[model samples]
Target: MSGQGTGRKARLAGSLLPPPGPARMLAVAALVTSLGFGGYTAGSVLFFTRGAGLSTGQVGVGLSLAGLLAVGGNILFGRLADRWGPREITMVVGGLQVVALLLSTVVDSFAMFLPVVCLLGVSEQAGKVCRNALIGGAVDGDDLVRTLAYLRSVLNGGIAVGAMLASIAVRYDTRSAYQILLFAIAGVSLFGYSLYLFVPRTRPAPRLRKKKDFPKAPPSISYVFTGLLCGIVNLGDTVLTVGLPLWVIGQTAAPKPMAAWLHAVNTLLIVLLQVRASRGAKTITGATRLLRLAGWTMAAACPVFWLAHDFPAVWASIALLIGVLLLTASELWNSAAIWGLSFSLAPAEARGAYLGKFSIGTTLREVFGPVLVIGLITGTGGSGWFLLAGLMAFASACAGPVVRKAQRESGVSDGTLARGRSGSG
Candidate 1:
């Protein structure tokens, strides 16, 4: 690290949140990138249908398939980040994002739109892997979770601002409004990518470390299973983002606007409290505790949502608010826990690769979580919510044994276990 980098790190050490520099750069990039995406998202359906002349079904099917295709980028780039270093790959991906945006902007017909959207999807995934690896590498130990929380908090803020601004387009409901927003979004991607150049560069981490240096390291395979477990527990997220809103409208007496208000509360609470929530997550066992907490809280919240369906209108509103609170709690704690565990779960030899593979677990949730949520909850009845809750709680409970198994198999220290630190559970 240069003197400049050293100074930045020192400042960050004392600060409660991520200090300015690479972390700041990533935050700015997240904000602008999310801002642009939000603008388009506010009117994306109209852009595809009226502006691009595509049918509603075409946009739905096309984007869904595109998301599935996009999921492989993390695995594909995991090794690249390992071999070439995160900064190098991140710059390349940023450029690719520019190209993807250009292709999306140029699409005039549905045929062109399909491939362009798929390209955008892949680019989006690639950028997330590169940028996350870059941030993970740039920030030193323990600070990773808090730093990531800061970035996420900023991104949500941007999305909120952008969503508000996007209503102008929605209100006008014109092709010109859609085009202006779309083009502006492409511009935002270009600007954000350019800023990637200013972030400090780093070389690949050392491939070999002696046990004397740090004992109790696990092999790569153990984390794959761990990632799979983390990903499944992460379904709690999809439940909040997708399943809960639907449940509110379809099953409960709460009005449709209540769903939006719940989301607003969720976002606001994250921005306000994510850093404080990250404090207990420095150790692997601590991370497991947080994940377990997230699972049970989410599970517990479901019954509240179900209760809203049967309660009187006044009670229903109260139940729904309580449910949202629990869901938001799960989201905040799970995020910090995942960030710490993901980075800590893997040792130095291939941290980027491990994180990338770990991320696949979340991607798996994004792609298939809706199906599980809809099939179980929507297809059945309010009971489906309880079933989903039980599953999440079980998954949360697995964090401890999984880490212990990884340690036992790889000949690492079960120090946490020996110390009676196998999480609160």
Candidate 2:
């Protein structure tokens, strides 16, 4: 009996382990990087305000400027990664980030802070594009999305641990504590991303053939359209985080602390279930179907959120929890679909360039999504939720046809689509 139990336990443990590949190295790097960055980010506002003596407005403006500059920089870096090599580019960018983080530890004025922050932002975004391109080169087909799912889960776990530790500094609210945390972040970041040296190098993607190919040689109109649509649908993330917090605190009777708990629940759910949710996203059709489901799921959550406003405290909390569950489900479905489609839709020859352009939509979302969410849902007495529901449903409905049309235009056959590899340049 004891021998049989040991065998079953060993099998279960083996089943729980991530498959061995380049993704394993990437996952470890992501975790370490997230741990350091997460700790710093959680306490950064306080650091800037207290340690550096900068006003909130200055910090906000500086960060916004950095974000704007990173938009174009992402494209440039992506092209460079394709021309050079993703592994090399990633290491170079990672080194820059280490430098920037170290500089951030001593930035005492808005002028000094602005440039450092911009460099950090641009480098970070470029690193992401390069890393994704690396994954595209390193892994293939169904395993691509699977690897991303696993990385995300590991990153989240690291961030959670880091944030918990940083909370002590946050609680102290002292300049010394903040500086210590910042220095630690820089040191950790330096050590963490150095693991990239272990990741096997990938070949540079093929160069563009014609100068007059598409107006944008790497990113076609079809890709831009799909990316933008995906970004819009991904607004569900903003709704759950920003919109829900505002709604619960200001509009509903739920306790103020409930927002934090809801966020915790979201992070936990994603870590536990993201890989499972990515199961059907290995092919274009499968990804498109998942996206549609995500839209409907998000739409369903809107009503639940709207309904929460009418309930008593206990009931309101319950409604919010259920609503969050629905939103998280939508997030899982949408993320899986996006990861699969983003890679499979692009030509392998210019994967970095295509993925870089695709990432702009996500950047735009970070820029505009919050403002739209707050403006619509804050003062509209929940009527904005109805409009959002309609938008999600319509977007979901459009995904299938849009993806199919793009596939046809790209001249990729159904078999190619099913394999989730190879697209026309």
Candidate 3:
């Protein structure tokens, strides 16, 4: 009976993982990629400042510049992926990333660091666009959103593990330790990039040129609008990461350590529930509904967080925990909706370009989200929470109509949007 119980547990665990194939392979690659980058992200500032002899201001400027450049670079790379084939572009981007990471180790001046970091950012952004295109072409529609959800979960898990591992380097607080960690991260990333070789090549999309080969077609503006709305909704993440910690430490009576615990809980919940949230989101209408739900849930959580400041230590902790739960729900739902809509809304042949264009909103948010969330929550105090709630609600309200309009304009039926996937779950 004990042996049987062990066997049953194994089966159940295996059932929770993606079926063995392209999805599984990609998940493994994503996991490895995240593991390396996670550590690098956690420790990059110290590495640049201490090991590379760059100042904090220089690193910040360099990263900001890299981010801005990557915004346009991602779109260009996505188009190239469509024209030149995703597999080939992805391989090229991967090679660039490995080279940039390795070169970063030898940099001793801001001038040298700036170009290497920019190269890294460009490669990273292009890699994301190409991977999305590859998955769109390789995976069946039934599993497209599910595969994305699974990969996200894997990435979160890997990052958490990598962060924990990097704590050793952080504790050492020496240049050599930082350099070693950077080198190890590069090696791991190269290994992860190699795994992409096993993934089947996605068919290249048609070139954007007209029949006469005069001018290329302009990208769709509708996707840009939808992407912006999705990016605004994603400010929920910024709130969780930035607003909550600040509020807990500055305003709430809850223990400051509660902030870290809340983040851990957020990660854990996402890793466990992201896949389940993605269900029923195959259709555009279904995805829109989920977006609305995310907005409503987040709206509710905002007030709860505001109220946490009024509570004593224990009650404040409880209230904050509940708020995190609600926010996590919002995050999960929003992510699922975005994945479904991004995949469903694109023209199949222009998948890479569309995906890259859709990502512009996210890129803008990364640039602006933290500042906006902090201003809203900390600047206005309690009123700011209600204002944020209203903003999210408004964005959510707009999402459904926007999606419907896009669907109509594109002349894509729910069946066509879902491809072989089931409608409305």
Highest lDDT scorer: 3
**1-425 in candidate 2: lDDT tens per residue?**
99999999976543333577677888888889889877976888788888889998898787777777877888888877767677788888888988887888788999898999889888888888888887777776547888888887887778888888899898988888888888888888888878888887776423444433422434357766677778878898888778989999998889999998998999899888888999888778888888899989998998888888989999999999999999999999988888877777777766777888888877777667877888888868889989889988998888888888777776665434223332211
Model 3 ranges off by over 4 Å: 53-55, 205-219, 418-425
Q: Name the top TM-score candidate.
A: 3
Per-candidate Cα lDDT values, in order, are 0.72, 0.80, 0.82
Better of 2 and 3 by TM-score: 3
Local error of candidate 3 at residue 389 (angstroms): 1.7
User: What's the TM-score of each model vs. the native?
Assistant: 0.86, 0.91, 0.92
Clashing pairs in 3: none
Report the candidate with higher lDDT, 2 versus 3: 3
Model 3 C-alpha lDDT per residue in residues 387-408, reported as the tens digit of each score:
9999888988888888787777
* Candidate 3 weakest ten by summed lDDT: 416-425
**C-alpha lDDT of residue 382 in model 2:** 89
Model 1, residue 236: C-alpha shift (Å): 3.3
